[model samples]
Target chain A: MTKERKPKPVFIEGAISAEFIGNSIAKHQSKTTIGAHDIFLGQVRADQIEGKTVKAIEYTAYEDMANSKFHDIREATFKKFNLTCMHIYHSLGTVKAGEICLFVFVSSPRRVDVFNAIEYLVNTIKEQVPIFGKEIFEDQSHQWKVNS
Target chain B: MTLKIKYFGMLAEITQCEEETLSFSKGTAADLLKVLFEKHPILEEKEFQIAQNQTFISNDSIISNAEIVLLPPFAGG
Candidate 1:
């Protein structure tokens, strides 16, 4: 009998570390059937607004809805792409500028599937996910972030 | 009926609270907005989407669920 897969938790409390990402990759080594892998990392940019420099981003979410939407996106991606596996992670709490906030990993047996799948996944996450970011300036002022 | 409303992102900032319950005797999403605008007049100037039971709706949809969420522009990557 095939094992039923459960949805992985997408939101973590802080920035995604390089060690975590490296370990994720290492775990895939045993799955020798995958020939190509693609990754997308979204970093918090220190954006300057109105002459104020942002020092960190405090992330928040409609957690229930965001997770459901992520599940839908994952299912849709699997239906549309020939991906061997996929993983998505996003930060929920404060992440400083220059730290990683979002990580997506996708694998496929061929390179073309991964090249197109990564772009689709990234764009879909930006458009559909119910996650918010507050840009905190060095002076303690803050502004809400909007996707462009 | 009492409706549970959650405000997120910039909307939360404007509302100054994340969630609250509104005793809405009137029906549907538009009616709720009318009452909300009466309280938070500044919301009329802001752009957002209303989700009923986690599903987004436009104007004049009947509200069948108490769980409503106000979502501002999505900034997630």
Candidate 2:
């Protein structure tokens, strides 16, 4: 029989702090089977658009749908790679430029599994998830950001 | 059928509201979008994708009267 696992909630209120990420690593120390850990942190960039600088990104999502999509990604990663554990965190509100907005953590007993898994997870999340970001400008003007 | 339509990101800016229940008589996803276009002409110039009942659908897909969400290009990283 397959064990049913509840999907881990991934949305953070604002920017993901460095302390929280550190704590996540600390908590994983007890999982001795994990010999390697790979992490991907998405930091917001300050882009100059049409003579205006981007101040921050205000993120929003169809929450129920996003959560389910994340679960689907997790399942696919597990099926495609031999992983001991995985975690994903994404900011739901305003994240200032240079702050972390998305974090993906994966652990495996072998180094190669995590290297490939991280790239796959990040790309899939960007391409498949429904999360949206509004790039807020310094002067309060804003524009929608699309993944390219 | 009254369909619950949700707007996200820049699309919400065009719609001027996050969500609303619109009475849509029988039609495909594209047909319902024609109604939205009449309500908000600006949406006609924007790019986005449609998801019915949380699953992405093509514009020509038949509507099953489920919750429809209009998503602009994804920017999440």
Candidate 3:
């Protein structure tokens, strides 16, 4: 039976630690009906631009609007896929290079649904959400990051 | 009527403030842009989309909402 889910807060203050991700996976262990699981992690890359190397990224968002958009995405994903549960988390503040900035987890009775749902959720979040990233360079300079 | 306007991302950098209130009587989104452009000329050169009531609207869309947002290119994952 599909369970009705409410929109939960998705923004984290800083980098999402491995411990948090591990705990989340551990929590799902009790749900034996979930036959497959899929996860996606977005890491902050040290990109080079204009000869300056990025050291970290400072993220910001239109919180109320972002949360509303996230809720819509969650609802749509649930409608499209036969998933048991899903979770999404994104970093709001400075996330250094090599740190995890976004985490998406999905589970279902089978593998195909989890795979498709993960892709849709990540792409929709990237294209539609109002989250902004300011790339901080090693030299202390910065520039706005645009998804390419 | 006073409208609350919000600027996001690079657009906010140009405006120097994340949000503000402006006194505007009646017009389309284009007319509101004219007033904003006059106040912050640099905003005219920046690329952005206008949203009202959390939904994107065309330039000619009538301004009936009390809140508007200027959003630049999104960089999210």
Candidate 4:
């Protein structure tokens, strides 16, 4: 039987810390049924626009819609994959260029499930979610970021 | 009807506010866009999508008394 999972908040205030990521992995140790784990982390890139360099990214979202889309994605993923568990987190406010902004973790009983699930989750989040980012430059000017 | 319109990302920057309530006449989503375009002409040049009550709607969809959102191109990871 498929278990129903409640949707949890996914937005973090700033950068997702390494410590938090480590703790999440540690917490999954008790779930012995999972043998393979796949992790994807998205870091802010300091791209050069003209002569300016990006310093940080400020993120915003249509909260209600984004959350609903995330929930739908989660449901669809569970139906498509034979995975044990999954977690997704994205930054809300400003995150420095070198900091982490998005983290996706998926675990399953076998390696193939995790490998495929991680790709789907990350790609879907980028294409479907209503989150936006402002690429803030060092001189305080900014440009909107669009997924390629 | 008073429609609450919310703007996100670059749309908000162009609109100069996150949200505002406007008194709109009953019409389709395209009609509402005409009114918004007159007020914020720059918006016509930008690319975006429209959502009503958190659901994406096409241009011909009828507008009701509900929350509307203007969303730019998504950049999430």
**Across residues A1-148, which tens digit of lDDT does each residue of candidate 4 receive?**
8677899889999999999999999999899999999999999999998999999999999888899899999999999999899999999999999999999999999999999999999999999999999999999999999999
lDDT of 1 at A51: 96
- Model 1, which residues run further than 4 Å from truth? A1-5
Candidate 3: stretches off by over 4 Å: A1-4
Worst 10-residue lDDT window, candidate 1 chain A: A1-10
Give Cα-based local distance difference scores for all models: 0.92, 0.92, 0.94, 0.94
Clashes of each: 0, 0, 0, 0
Q: How well is candidate 2 docked (DockQ)?
A: 0.89
Summarize candidate 2's per-residue lDDT along B1-77 as a digit string, tens digits: 88888899888887798999889888888898899999889999998999987898897898986589899999888
Tell me the tens digit of each residue's lDDT in model 3 across B1-77: 89999999888887898999999989999999999999999998888889998899998999999999999988887
Poorest 10 consecutive residues by lDDT, candidate 1 chain B? B22-31
Docking class of 4: high
Model 2 CA deviation exceeding 4 Å by range = A1-3
Candidate 1 residue lDDT tens string, B1-77:
88888899999899897899988886878888999999889889999999987889987898778888999999997
Distance (Å) between predicted and true CA of A67, model 1? 0.4
Interface RMSD values for all candidates: 0.6, 0.6, 0.7, 0.6
Model 1: DockQ vs. true structure: 0.89
Cα lDDT over the full model 3:
0.94
Rate residue A52 of model 1 by lDDT: 94
Order by DockQ, highest first: 4, 2, 1, 3
